[model samples]
Target: MRIRKKIWNNDAEPIIAIMVVLMVLGTINVFSSSFVLGTTDYENPYHFLRRHVLVMLAGLVLFFAFRKINYRRWRPLQGPLMLAVIGATFLSLVGVLVIGTEVNGAKRWLFGAQPAELAKLVSLMLAASTLSARIKRGKANSLFNVCNMKYGLIVVMAVLIELEPDMGTAAIVLGVPVIMAVVAGMSFKYVLGLGGFLALLILILVNVQPYRMARLKVWFDPWADAQGMGYQTVQSLSTIGSGGFWGMGLGEGVSKYEYLPEAHTDFAFAIFSQEHGYMGAFLVFLLLALLVLFCVRIANRAPDEFGQMLATGIMVLIAGQAIANIMMVGGLLPVVGVPLPFISYGGSSLMVSMVAMGMLLNICDHGRNAGGEFPKGEAKVTKSKDNKVHLKLVK
Candidate 1:
């Protein structure tokens, strides 16, 4: 009874449904990928599946609880949230510098308790809040007058993220606000100019870092040095290709048996493609597309600019990670080390992704609430007393 209430109590059914589908797919696929990885440790190969269940439970709890609270409550948390995340990202970067943990020759952590991920969500919200306030004050349409107040704050946050050397995430974080600014009615000329400048900055960043250049070179053709920086991409392609149409069959993949590096983390998509085959890979992509479409729909129906921006930021967050992960796996882009959102085996990424989904659901809930109220013991709804009806007759 209690479980039913928790699961069915939301007005955000469409958003919740998308998350549920992803969680289910992720859980099944991870089992398919990790059973063999865990077989040596436990008699049952479903060890990771058990852990996945626990993680999903924790995530669902957060989902329901977060749904009850208004997201506006996060407004006051913006400054402190940014500070805390920046501190954590810096600590992780410096921690890697001091006692760095190396995986596949990269300093990114396997246990990314790093605040960078959390910062992505906070930074998005902060940017949304900052920009939304301007729009509400009717300054959004004003040329040379918008984005002046909190622009400093946004830049400082971006610089701190870039300082961590997490260019992929920093790029997405910065890009989102720019999108929000444009959507909020910032002038097109300004957006075009800002985008050009951002591109130049990225070029400089790539020029300055030898490894970044190497990754890009390998992205163009990993075969150039298959045994060097090109190694992972080559392995990823081989693994993905080996899967063919139906895949070699789950737990039967040759790659996760140690052929592919980062098999359980950042490059887990390669493992997935190997086990599930093209059909499986296509299904995963389809679900992701559906998830993206649903999030955008929710954003379109959002009651206010804050809600719209929040929904949009979260959608971009998921879509960005998906595109980056897929491109890396497919050998179309450098391995920027962004994990596959729901499908990757992770702690911080999993929970935070769930939180972002929760926020998305919260946005939908408000839309549904405004639309109608559920009648007791019935799924259909009627107008609530608290809300004034605004109707337009058919013209």
Candidate 2:
């Protein structure tokens, strides 16, 4: 008997390494960006730093816990998970509207955490479970039914998050699932139709909110309102521009002192760019892009449909948020309050993202254990009369 050489190494190593680097760097960035805010707001320079450390600890706990659980287990508990996630999300959104803390005109927090952040993970799970189940059952061929089955819960969650006026997260919660559905074999016709509808809805939502419209205006002309509505954008651009090709130096950027609002949260990328330069920012982007690529590889080798969709959904969740944060900070897109994955200082976002990464790692482990081929079989590539290649699984 001959043994086959391994064609790929373990996928978890690079991912875990990237994650650790980001967390350490994120801690440093948070300290630098939030020092002034911490001192002025709470009279303690370490206020945000301490909270960030605690959050990082919490996220690590979740990451390790989820890593031990098998990705396939999520299949059997999909129904219950959906119900619990929806119930929690609905209650949280309602609670925010009624009594949750309102900061900067948005009521997006409850019990000291952002429920909308958790909503992104839960909605992704539900979407993955639904789409994968349909694909396995041969129901994915019907666009209408697939949309109804997979999208109902996602639409509900998106609407609630949008109402929270956290449009950044809402777009992610909605967008990730759509990407998963498309990957799971939803027809392009239905995708375009729904895409158009969602775009129009977003337009309406933007037009109705004065702040959102103001953001749009700033996107087009940041200098026009440099001192008012465009202050954040102009400040962010100036910080990056000041950094040149390489950043000023770690902990040396002055924009975080008072110029850029939300420097530690929505605009952390700008702070990072200022301190580390465009080269550092590019490295971060490269890391995230590699993360997504590894995720796609895992999805291809997932032991089952559930694992495939789950991995894909996780990739979308992280990559989508990363792109949004980078684009907004670079002034290529309007500011949308999206945090950079693994590098932003929000407890809920960090925790949820870590949990999602844990699941992705689990899938990678499972795929490796399955010999890097799903369904516990060998795949033979064959060409048909039409000259198209076909994959046949052999026992």
Candidate 3:
């Protein structure tokens, strides 16, 4: 007990506390929302709950493993790490097309792994590593080249995910890197070109699929086709609306019983809003806000450009997914089927999210010792007498 207390006191308290709270609440809500589905499909009311608990246990192991590692150690091997992530993700994405399990008409999972979920984090890492390396080398002229190369891979990953029909994860995998590049001081002209290109791609993508077009139509007016493409959104909104202020009380929501699709996965927020009510929803948002704040605080205190970029990327990924989930459930945006981070009942997403959180905590710990003053002048890397590149952060 003393040892555990010491560990907690020595780490980032707010992040730890908030993560625990979210996990506990999420576990409870998963049981509440998924019991019916679990029973009907698997003949066990506790199937999802049991699976979620096991997944959460594995996630906890990953969390602690990442927390114990020094964040800077990754800097030395960023290139190889980036390549490995890209290669692994690409294979998984390709493999899914060949032999993957198709869930709800989307081939997204392979051998119990969701590569799209992994893409979000790995792409973020590659973005940070690439941008930071270029910046440290002071390759201002080659900024566009780096952007093209790194973002080109990101685009490929996004395309693969989109082919899986999982546009929500694709958007996040693509969006976070663009945000990081802009913040990393990429050329304005290049950024503009990138933005225009992305807009064109989105336009083309929306038109390529009939269902996507239908989604857009529903986004514009769900009431027009309340029983077709808009069914899920309308159902989700009705669930939230029925919750009132304090909710119908925990374990008492009526929407989860074959009324709302994806009550424990993509639309978990709807179930949460229904059971917890407006106040409960607000508390969930509060927790997410605190999580984002803690990440920003860690980024601000990061020791170098890489740490800052990595931390910021993780922050965007988590907060973006959460916001997208909330908006989709609240009828403020088209249903993109993004899950609420740490709250949704999925092994792959939960594991990936916990890993990101662990990385954030690691950054927080290292940032505490990082000096307050920002490094002035560009960092330079030079080959020493031993032919090894030595990095020097100039003040």
Candidate 4:
């Protein structure tokens, strides 16, 4: 078995195909979803369509860049990750307070030196990389050890994200790494036990906040608060149901004509369904499903644990967020302001999604180029100082 020295190793077909389809669908959906608002708010009709094109182009470049990079050297990145995640997330939160731009009562940046949207991918990478190294270092007591430095950093990232009060992104930032943890040799018992505790904390967090609690209530019966908290849900469901099977046709939907707020952002899925109908919605689901399947295949083919875990983390981020957004529109869950993955009209979110995909492509390449199983000594299991089983990092 030969270990290759260069990158660009994986077949780029899966990553490329998934991204191309997403960009096409997202472009179509964004134009249709944003039309009414864009025209009424701006003089030119193609305002958002043009912007989406630019963002997509930039994201494509970044994705291809990730495809070319190596995934194995992240081990030395351990110490700097904490500082990086903290500095970046805080700067975004603070920028929204200081010189940062505000969009909808919440502080997030659009055009600036720092992009908060990028934090999703950045924080996940930092979290994933940190744990992969430690697990390799023989920390697999895997239970109590989960509470130490590995999870500690993740908790800090979650805290900062919660402070941003952007619960949607915070959920994802935490959730993706948790998936990676499970893949990186976490115990089923502890994972399930911790999952239960986290769910309880989420319930308490949602109820403790008056708005979150209100949203939950409205989710159950939006008609009850149609004039207040339930207004969005009521309108969303109406739009969704109004579409029925075949939809009203592109740019012909009544809801986007000022009936539904946020027709392009949080509620974009509703608009997409209203225009494309159940068929369109199903196609969206199919596209997303294919994306995940190929990504999983890539993960399975990964050359190393770092590559596999990183790919898994990206898949979870995209698929999880997409489901959250779509379910919110379906009235199956409370509205959480999560953007539909590739289809949302925001640059930061779209660009970051592609970048994460790019990282996965890199991992795939590493896997393909990697060529063989563990070198003789590499597979030997070792016990840590505390008698926990752990694997050694590939040199």
Model 1 ranges with Cα > 4 A deviation: 1-11, 35-53, 76-112, 141-151, 369-395
Per-model TM against the reference = 0.80, 0.90, 0.88, 0.84
Off by over 4 Å in 3: 1-11, 75-83, 137-146, 187-190, 369-395
Tens-digit lDDT string for candidate 2 (1-395)? 99878744577887898899889989999999999999999999999999999999988998999999877666634556546656777788778777888888888989898888878887787777787767766677456534564478778878887876788888888888877778777777887886788799889989988888988977899999999988888999999999889889998999988889999988888999999998998888888888888888878776667787899999988888888888888889997888998888889999999999999999887664434443346344445796444556656
lDDT of 4 by residue, 42-100 (tens): 97678889988998899888878766766554432445644565566656655555666
Please give the ranking of all candidate structures by TM-score, highest first, separated by commas.
2, 3, 4, 1
TM-score of 3: 0.88
Residue 355, candidate 2: Cα error in Å is 0.4
Task: Give per-residue lDDT, candidate 3, residue 163.
Answer: 90
Whose TM-score is higher: candidate 2's or candidate 3's? 2
The models' CA-based lDDT, in order, is 0.72, 0.82, 0.83, 0.73
lDDT of 4 at 45: 73
What digit string (tens of lDDT, one per residue) describes model 3 on residues 1-395?
45323334333687889999999989999999999999999999999999999999999999999888776655533557646767888899999988999988999989998999888987887778777776666653344634556667888999999998887789899999888877777778887887898899888988988888889888888989999888888999999999999999999999999988999998888898898899999999999998898788778767666787899899999999999889888888888868899899999999999999898888777654333433364333445785444556656
Q: Which residue pairs show collisions in model 3? A: none
Error of 2 at 156 (Å): 1.6
